[model samples]
Target: MIRVLIADDQSLVRAGFRVLIDSEDDMVVVAEAGDGATAAELTGGTRPDVVLMDIQMPGTDGLEGIRRITADPDLAAVRILILTTFDDDAYAVAGISAGASGFLLKTTAPAQLLHGIRVVAGGEELLAPGLTRRLIARLTTPTPPAVDDTTFADLTAREREVVTLVAEGLSNDEITKRLFISLATAKTHVSRALGKLGARDRAQLVTLAYRHGLVRPD
Candidate 1:
């Protein structure tokens, strides 16, 4: 089962999420916290597979909690998905930079929210292409120097191609179709790329791709 922890300041919000998650046969809410500090503490103790974290909590906040959790080697398997208001794109970017698996608007449909949790728990990045492009572009001011080829010198040309498509927000099935390769091949390429890049997950790979200029904002 995929264990989840809900971290939101509002009791009603936590209760609602608990009910929804408990209804899933393949998932469960193992714990809940009303603040970032408590969330971080529970994560260490419970070691949940996924955390649905509210970005704005009373203290410590989601960003700091994410940082703390991601920094702990013992919690490396935990995936954090930030919950944000519709207009809080900046918070989403910050959460991603701090090692969150992804972010979702609180208004997201129930089906989509469930799917996103599964995706993140299964070690996939869940980004809408347009939103990702915009978020990266907005934060790319005073652009850093393009990542040197040597940085990815370990990856084969085909693997590099696969990584680029992943950064473009394509799913493994999409990559398979785009490259006319088998689904297993696509998955293998992505896995290999992740290993070579030393990325914790696909989201980190996407961030690296952007920072290194493999994928341009435009």
Candidate 2:
């Protein structure tokens, strides 16, 4: 089963999330915290596969908690999905830079929330398409200098192609069709590219690509 931790200041919110997650046969909530600091503590102790973290908490806030958890080498395997009611672009950037896997508006449906948890846990990335486009646009507003080739020196030719396709927002299935590769091959390439670039998820990779001039807004 996929082990999950719910971190939010509101007790009702945690209870609601727990009910939805527990209903899934393939997932379970292993712990819950009302603040980011406690969430970090629970993550270290529970070693949950995924953490649903609220952005606004009484203490240590979500972004700081994300930074702390990700900085720990032993707890690095835990994937953090930021749960927020706000849709501010700067907040999104902050969370992504702090190593959050993805951001989801709290108004999202229960099914979408569950799917996001599974996707992040499976080492895949999840971003709401509209929000994703806005995020890319925000990052590309002031074009940065050209990326040095050395930035991608570690990637093989195939891996570079995969990263380029990912920057174009192609899903694994679409990538497979375009590249004439098997599903598993596409997934492998995506994973390899992420590791080489030190990206936590597709959202981060896309931002990096835009910042490095790997992709551009139309």
Candidate 3:
């Protein structure tokens, strides 16, 4: 089962998420926290597979909580999916930089939310379409540049293609179909590109691609 922890300041939101998550046989809500501090404490205790973190918590705030959890050697394996209403590119970029596995708008459909949890738990990043472009644009500063070619130039030509497709918000399966390659091959290329680029996950890949001119936002 995919164990999940919900950390939102609102009781109603927590309850709604719990019900939606627990309804899935493959998932369960293991704990809930009203603030970032409590959420961090619960994460330490539960060691949940995924954490649904709120962005504006009272104590530490979601960004800090994410940093704390991801930085811990013990809890490094746990994934965090920021649950927030704001779709601010700056906030999302900061969260990704801090090692959050993904970001989900609180208004996300139940199926999408569940899919996000599963994707992050499986050691992948979630970048739902429009948000992907926002993250890239936010991180890409023309003067300074968020990523230098030195970081991305290490990728092979094929791997660069894969990275570009990922930045375009294509999934592994979609990349496979577009490139006429097997699914495993597509995944391998993406993994290699991410490693060479020193990206944490798909989200970072999107940012790196745009920052390096591999892909441009629409």
State which candidate has the highest lDDT.
1
Ten residues in a row with the worst lDDT in model 2?
84-93
For candidate 2, what is the lDDT? 0.84
Model 2 misplaced regions, further than 4 Å? 144-147
Estimate, for each residue in 79-123, the C-alpha lDDT of model 2 and write its tens digit: 988876545566667887778888888789999999999988986
lDDT of each residue in 49-103, candidate 3, tens digit only: 9999888877678888887887777987788898765546566678888878778
Evaluation by TM-score, superior candidate among 2 and 3? 2
For every model shown, what is its TM-score relative to the native structure?
A: 0.92, 0.92, 0.86
CA RMSD per model (angstroms): 1.9, 1.7, 2.5
Write the residue-wise lDDT of candidate 1 on 95-116 in tens digits: 8878898887788889999999
> If candidate 3 were superposed on the true structure by all CA atoms, what would the RMSD be?
2.5
What is the lDDT of every predicted structure here?
A: 0.87, 0.84, 0.81
Per-residue error (Å), model 3, residue 3? 1.4
lDDT of 2 at 4: 98
From the highest TM-score down, the ranking of the candidates is 2, 1, 3
Model 3: ten consecutive residues of lowest lDDT: 140-149
